[model samples]
Target: MAKIDIRRPHSLSVADARSIVDRVAERMREKFGTDSQWSGDTLTFQRSGVKGAIAVVPGEVHVTAELGMLLSPLKGTIEDEIGRKLDEHFA
Candidate 1:
């Protein structure tokens, strides 16, 4: 398994950060059939080969995921896509 850990500092409020994360979750669900839910400030998401959480804090957003063996090889691509999304949303 491969792990993806991305942290980005943001100026948005917790609520706003959550909104962005929710949008991201929705896209993931629509595109990849992911299952996601919110537990306070964290949004946890999972699918067959991926599992992750987006945590919204006062000044930052942290994304962490574990990829199954089959998906491990594409880790860089996945991470880059995520970074692009984060840049679009928060940067």
Candidate 2:
């Protein structure tokens, strides 16, 4: 599996961060056929093709994504899509 991580510093409160993560996770789940859940500062996702978690701490948000071996050939596309979504959310 290939792991991709994105880190951003934001001024959002814990609750707001959680909400954003939850929303983003849901969107990702629907679009990518993944399972996602949020717990406090962490949002985790698992699917046959990929798995990962997003961790939010204080003023920082970290997104980590792992692509399965079967999907390794599309790693660049996957990473680019994730980066785009993160940019949309943080912007």
Q: lDDT of model 1 at residue 45?
A: 95
lDDT of 1 by residue, 1-91 (tens): 9999999999999999999899989999999999999999999999999999999999999999999999999999999999999999999
TM-score of each: 0.98, 0.85
Tens digits of per-residue lDDT for model 2 on 1-91? 7778888777888678778888877776787788887676788889897888899898878888788798888988877887787677765
lDDT of each: 0.95, 0.80
lDDT of 1 at 39: 92
Q: Could you report the Cα RMSD, in angstroms, for every candidate shown?
A: 0.5, 1.5
